[model samples]
Target chain A: MERCGLYLGCNIPLKAPDIEQSMRKVFPALGIEIVDLDGFSCCPAWGTAPSFDIDTWLVVAGRNIAIAEMKGVDLMTGCNSCFGVLSEAKHMIEEHPEKKAMVQEKLAKINKTYEGKTKVYHIAHILYKEIGLEKIRKSMKYKLDGFKIAIQPGCHILWPTKVMEVTEKNPFYPTMLKELCEALGAEAPYYSRLEYCCGMGALRSTDQEKSFLLVKEKLLSMKEEIDPDMIVTTCSSCYLQLDGAQKILKERGEIDFTIPVLYYTQLLALCMGFDAKEVASISEIPREEIIEKIQSEERAQ
Target chain B: MQVETVNLTQKDRKAVLAQMIEKGGGNLTKCIQCGACASVCPVAITGLPLYCKRLFRFLQTGHLEEILDDASSWACVACNRCTEICPRGVDPFHVVFAFRRIQAQELAIPASATTSLMNFYTTGHAVYGDASELRQKVGLDPVPPSTLKYPEALKELQTLLDESPMAELGLF
Candidate 1:
């Protein structure tokens, strides 16, 4: 089993470490060895690059990819922003030879050169392509047993259709994660806003009040149709928006609905028999009931 | 003292503006003034004139100063919802980012948020820098290492920062 570096990016390792842990556990079972790409920072999202300084964004992202190339493995990221940024940079470098030359020239100063050989894959792609939905089905230890989930595909992950390759109109395009949950015995509820953004993009960073209101509207819409036990997502930023923004809204005398947000890995961890505390730690949502449920199971055992 | 307007040359402004258009995924020059982007913009609807069309107009007119100074620019939530709905795929999110970069260069970010961002940049983590310190205080594991040291790379970045007129505006 060859190894691949997992580019945890800025958010998950800091704000959602459980996602990293769960991913580590699940990926190995799927035949991929997970390694860390040390020394990578924010990818800056959209903030680091000025109009004239896109070379810097390309160089930095290229350098991170170069680190994984050095390790002799493709990069796997759970963060949608990281995937989008790194993947886009890689595509740009490969497609434009002149741009690649300029980026390499700048990178030479840092002793980093991106040859554009490595591929960037989101965790979902790995689960679907490498792990195979059938293999995941066989590995299931516990079933979700009717867990209704709304798949909130972050904008960076499934949008612009040109990148990400995940289909928007077709419900089946993003069905790997949903199928993975089903394999473990959870029910994935399909909704119109299933492919919506959680409002965590540049908008959220710049205008938070407006961002929160927008997020509240999306969450309310999701709640209306699915009333899901939880909204599962692969993007940490979306998790923050759906989970943290909801709490922020409630504190501000907004709606009072408590919906726990879980990373797909955490849900997989639950089915794999990890304690809810361990799994829930990755979740932005509070973990009392989940912890209690796991505790009761422990007591029964 | 003679007050020269000190208008930035078209060449200099175009150099900076090109990056904004590319990153923003919008043709600042192509906006037809239909105001569709503005009409559907969640931020604009919330009473901020930071609509995509207006943002494009500001960038097109080289009114960087006005756009950067305006609070409406910061009101863009980067949700990219506007971009999705834009008949023209005019990404307001990217335009907002371009403004943020200007804010960083001008050292014009709100004082409170600047302090928080500075803490994260210096300490490597947002709330606190040292994982051990965070653990000692909060009884949690040390924060994972997301930042890697490339002295050579950072040195190169430092040069880029120094040359930038907006370098003085950066918190770090």
Candidate 2:
């Protein structure tokens, strides 16, 4: 069995455990072994902004990459923030000799070093590359004929464009996830603000009121215009901000909609004919609607 | 609280100003002090006392201490709101990032609260401790420790890092 290191950054383990479970169950079915890296920590959230210590951030991120390197497989992550930090750090080591030296010097105490040996890939990149969309199409057990889904490509996944291996300015830059959804037979809604940020980055940490306001704007617009049956995201942070903030918004009498938020993996698992219990276990969203949809389809068949 | 006074010589201020110009694309000098960046700044709108225009003025005048010391500098969401609305095309996001880099280099990290973020970079997994312990703490199922399956690959990585002089420095 071919193994790939699965890099699960902070939020997925604590806040969104179902995402981790879905990836574990589904990737193996797709012919990829999910391996873990010990002694790895956060990507320090984002890049080491000037106010933050560069060496510490680099060492912290470098150590994680080093752990993956220690395992000898390309690092695959589910979190966009983790992807961004690891990818950028890997790229920095590859591109700049001095920065690599500086970061390595700091890692020496921990007996770790980043020699730019491991390549970092997000789960979307892996699904699109390793388990090709055509293969995913062949694995689909159920077709999502009536479901309309909206794609929200969080900023970390899209920005600094080259790292993501997609065209940022274009509407279809994050086509892989959308394609995966379509291959499983769901309608992918194209909205005007599809490429806009969820504004859930540092905003959630520093200025939450502003963060919720941004979430409210995005969710309201997504509901009013696109009218997706569900909002599917790859980033765990985006999942929390969208799913958690929606409840907060409804409680405050701001909006009266409950658009289910799902990780792409859960949707894929459901389409692959996994049990609703297993699907619900891996999804933060309630599986009632999806279960009912599948059952109704079964009766029609 | 009284605002702390900053003292800098003309040469010192000019040097820092030149560095900011070179690193930030010379946009910091183009501010007409119009307050346009401030008027549109989202953080300022939230009543946080953070103004990109004021930050630019501080950079130009070499009064970076106040800007560097303030927690508001790190609060920028990189939303590009100010950058998009700036008539001068000044990229406040880049400015904020550059300032953040400077702060990180100076080792002035705040020490008020601990965040789980620290655990993310050290272990590829985010939470600290073993998977079972973390699972119990967070009320999740215990996941087995997932390591890379290939031993030869790990050996090669160790050799590569071992060859570099910087790796021997052991700063981490």
Candidate 3:
């Protein structure tokens, strides 16, 4: 079994425990060992720390990376912001020795040192790369049974591709997230707005009305095209944005749809014969209906 | 569209753009103003002028004030779609960040952004509260293994920030 440090950034560990539960429940079944990463700090988040102070961003990110290095393993996270900011810091430190020195000085206070060699992995990419299609398919109990899923890979997983360890070769038209769903026996159809932002993070925080406008466009587009039974995404941010904002839009009468959302791991866990109550228990958005849909194998083509 | 004039002689040209470029704006002049960044911007699609293409063009021409009040900059989700689509390697997402930081430095940041930053400062996280009730429902250790669970780690994070500009800025 391959082993790696599980880096649970702020969002999943606190606000969305479901994602963390899903990761813990799913990885072991697939032969991936998740180390505790004891004493790990936050990824510092992009909008909050990284946006305001670059120096503070690197030191905090470096400290997290240093934990995995201490354990002699690579790092993996369910958060796109964590992956983006940490990976960006890793890139900056690698490219500039002076920046590395500054980070090293701060790390010295905490009695840790980051060699900057530990590669950061988003859960989706590593699962696709390390586990392979055959293993993922073999581990499934229900095989998704031809369920149609709308995919949102989130934004960070794609951009600043220079620093990202795993990125789509053709980011404009990505098939990685789609292909993973397909391997699990689901039909992930492509829509025109597949590349659009979900207006989470800074947008949603700054102006709800303006942010809703962007989510409204995506909801309307997805409702018109494909009309999939459910939504699945890799990053926690997209999961929160698309899942939460869709409900917000519906309440405001901005859209007339109710497609359920789940992390790819939660979906995989259900397919792997794990109890629905265990795998998807901590979800904030209503998922019981999606559970029934997955079991029934009825979807609009 | 009547283009408004930004008189170059009246402003110190390089001061604003230099800071932007330093903060990962990339080379603003490299932007071709092809509207590619605007085309992919989610906020732009909603009829807002939050176009990276225009932001760069304005920066290229020393018109920082032109795009300052536009709602798109605040509405930027930092999704990096514009940066991904850029042909000239100009990362508009970074430009948006530079603008947000400028706003943050001026203490014009929205309350929600400030709240998240404050949480990050105090708990070493953006979202922190007594979620032990929910965590127990998920069979978790109530607090997980982050700074909230370990006070010393939180202190270490505070120490790092105390030495950085975040302390003096008071945005967090």
Instruction: Give the C-alpha miss distance for residue B46 in model 2, angstroms.
Output: 7.4
Once fitted onto the true fold, the runs of candidate 2 whose alpha carbons sit more than 4 angstroms away are: A47-51, A105-109, A164-174, A282-287, A294-301, B1-12, B15-54, B65-71, B77-94, B101-172
Candidate 3 at A1: error in angstroms?
6.8
**Candidate ranking (TM-score, best to worst):** 3, 1, 2
- Model 1 per-residue lDDT tens digits across residues A124-210: 777766777788767666656656777776756664444444444543255656776676656887776566556675557667777
In candidate 2, what are the lDDT values of residues B1-172, reduced to their tens digit? 9988775446366777666654443677676778776764556655565567767667777776666666565566554545555777666666766665555445443432123323322333334455455444433457534322234433433433344432433322
Error of 2 at B10 (Å): 7.7
Top-lDDT candidate index: 3
Worst 10 residues of 1 chain A by lDDT: A292-301
Model 3 chain A is weakest, by summed lDDT over 10 consecutive residues, at A292-301
Among residues 3 or more apart in sequence or in different chains, the pairs in candidate 3 whose N, CA or C atoms overlap within 3 Å are: none
Docking quality tier of candidate 3? medium
Task: Report the C-alpha displacement of residue B31, candidate 1, in angstroms.
Answer: 3.4
Interface RMSDs of all predictions? 4.8, 6.7, 1.8
TM-scores of the models, in the given order? 0.80, 0.76, 0.92
**Better candidate by TM-score, 2 or 3:** 3
**Order of the predicted models by DockQ, top scorer first:** 3, 1, 2
Q: For each of the candidates, give the backbone clash count.
A: 9, 34, 0
Q: What is the lDDT, from 0 to 100, of the residue A89 in candidate 1?
A: 70
